[model samples]
Target: MSALLDEIFDVAGSVVLVTGAGSGIGRTIAETLAACGATVIGADRDEDRLGEIKDTQGVEPVHLDVADAGAVDNVVNSIVENHGRLDVVFANAGIARGGGLTTPQGTIDAFDLTAWHELLDVNVHGVVHTVRAAARPMKRQASGSIVVTASTAGLRADPLVSYSYVVAKAGVVNLVRQAALDLARWQVRVNAIAPGPFKTNIGGGGPIDPAVEARWGSTVALGRMGETRELRGLALLLASNASSFMTGCVYPVDGGALLQSLSLDPAE
Candidate 1:
């Protein structure tokens, strides 16, 4: 049984790259893969965060901004050039800069266009850039796995998240399917992880308010937000041979949040 498990979950020696790896789900994914014996490359725009993980064994930290198409291309190319292979990529870098309609700044009538465009640039264009650049070598090798970080907001209307967050994620969800189809011909797999709320730095690094947490918890069937560690198992599965036959699927690791509505009203 142990051997069977190893065969399925083993990712030893594989070269994997994770963007947005400075913190949150991306960091967990990078750390988990490194611990499992894969050569992990963690990329993030924050130099300080990169510095934190640079010394971690099996992890090669790279300073990068995914929104910059040129930088993303260079990073992807450099990886293949230096290592000769990139078996997996987690295009996970993203930002949530705006708020829902409940707040004055988040209201549609007064929506911040600058914030919207900035978020889209990173969340949408960044994913596109990463996937496009990674596909080059993956196609040449005739094998690779690209995992995207989408959100539950993208799957449905939610008043809790910002407009940019929802719009960007929704774009990537379909982009995953489209890319999966195109890459399938080269034996490359593309998939999306549509996560619900987890304890992460996306909302700025700190503990969430008790009241907000309570409200968010109520929307999830599990009655709470997920921890970053809960994502490791699924991420490993998607990254390893266990999911060799899987592609183009958006797996939700949301503690069953997708099953409930994002309504704050008790009457609803």
Candidate 2:
């Protein structure tokens, strides 16, 4: 049983790159992969956060801004040059700014263009940069796994998140599909992990108010927000050979958040 499990889920020695490794879901994924024996390149723009995990075994911390196409390309290319191959990439760097419909600032008429552009640059364009960069080496090797961090908001309309976030995630969901099809011939796979409300620093990185936490938790069927650690099993599955037959798929680790309807009643 142990050997069979290892054979199916083995990720040892796989060279991996995870963006946004400074905090939240990205950090969890990076740590999990590294612990599983994968040589992980954990990249983030926040040097401070990167410092937190710099000493983690099997993880190499690097400063990276996914929004910069050239920088992203450089990082990916350098990884391939140094490691000989990039077996997996987690394009998980993203930010949530501005307001959603629930807030007065989030209303369509009051939408903040500056925030929209800023968020999209990192959320949408950043994914594009990472995917494009990772695709090159993966195509050459003809075998690789690219897992993107999309949001459950992208899969449906949620008033709790910002307009920019929804648009960015929705856009990436299709982007994953298109990229998956394009990369299929080379035996490379692309997929998205549509996370629901997980306790992460994406929303300002501060401690959550108990009431607010409860509110977010109420949106999911499980009546709780997920911990970053909860994402590990699925993250590993997608990054490893366990999901060899999966591609262009969007799997939600939202604790059944999509199972219920979100009431728009502000008073509730």
Candidate 3:
């Protein structure tokens, strides 16, 4: 077993591109891969954030909005041109905005046009454009891994977060499955991570409400919110040869939160 992991999970020399690599899970993934010996290219719309990350971990940084069709393709092209090939593409860029019909201030309400567009643009269209760009090269290479970041809300509806957040994440999950099937013949693996409430900035900006977070933790079988590092092993597993036979599957790393019926404010 130990020998198998040593051989199968070796990421050395692989070229990986991680979108939204400026912060949170994307950042974690990039740094982890670098430490594990993969050549990582990190992309983000925030130039300064990208620069900061670049300075720290020696990642090649490219600035572009994932929603922009031309920019998306350009980023992919840049990676191929510079690295010769991209072995892993993690489309983990996403945003969250919460609102119900009654809350005119909510992100999905008609009044929140900018927020709604931002959510759809970054969360849905971004993933679409990104994966579309990656598919071709991965197909030609006949081997690659694509991991998408979805949410627990994607599996079921709840009032804990914004409506659009749930919808966008759900769409991402389906996209992973569909892409997985389409790329199977090419030996390109596509999978999604249905991460539960982690100490990240997606739904909650930075600091989660203590009470709300406590409530969510209570509902989880693990009795705590997940650490970002806990996901590193899982990410490497799916991206490496360990999961050569796994694709078109959504792995929920939610500490079993999806198993509980109790509703906690997911936004926290």
Best by lDDT: 2
Give the Cα lDDT of each candidate.
0.92, 0.93, 0.85
Q: Write the residue-wise lDDT of candidate 3 on 13-111 in tens digits.
A: 889989989888888998888887888988988887787797755477889799998999998998899889989999999877756433555444354
RMSD for each model, in Å, please? 1.4, 0.8, 2.6
lDDT of 1 by residue, 117-205 (tens): 99999999999999999999999999999999998988998888888888999999999999999999999999999999888888877
What TM-scores do the predictions have? 0.97, 0.98, 0.91
Reference-based TM-score, model 3: 0.91
lDDT tens string, model 2, 166-227? 99999999999999999999999999999999888888888988888998999988889999
**Which portions of model 1 show Cα errors greater than 4 Å?**
264-268
Better of 2 and 3 by TM-score: 2
Clashes of 1: 0
- Model 2, position 147: C-alpha lDDT score: 98
Question: What is candidate 3's local distance difference test score?
Answer: 0.85
Worst 10 residues of 1 by lDDT: 259-268
| lDDT of model number 1 | 0.92
lDDT score, candidate 2, position 15 = 99
Clashes of 2: 0
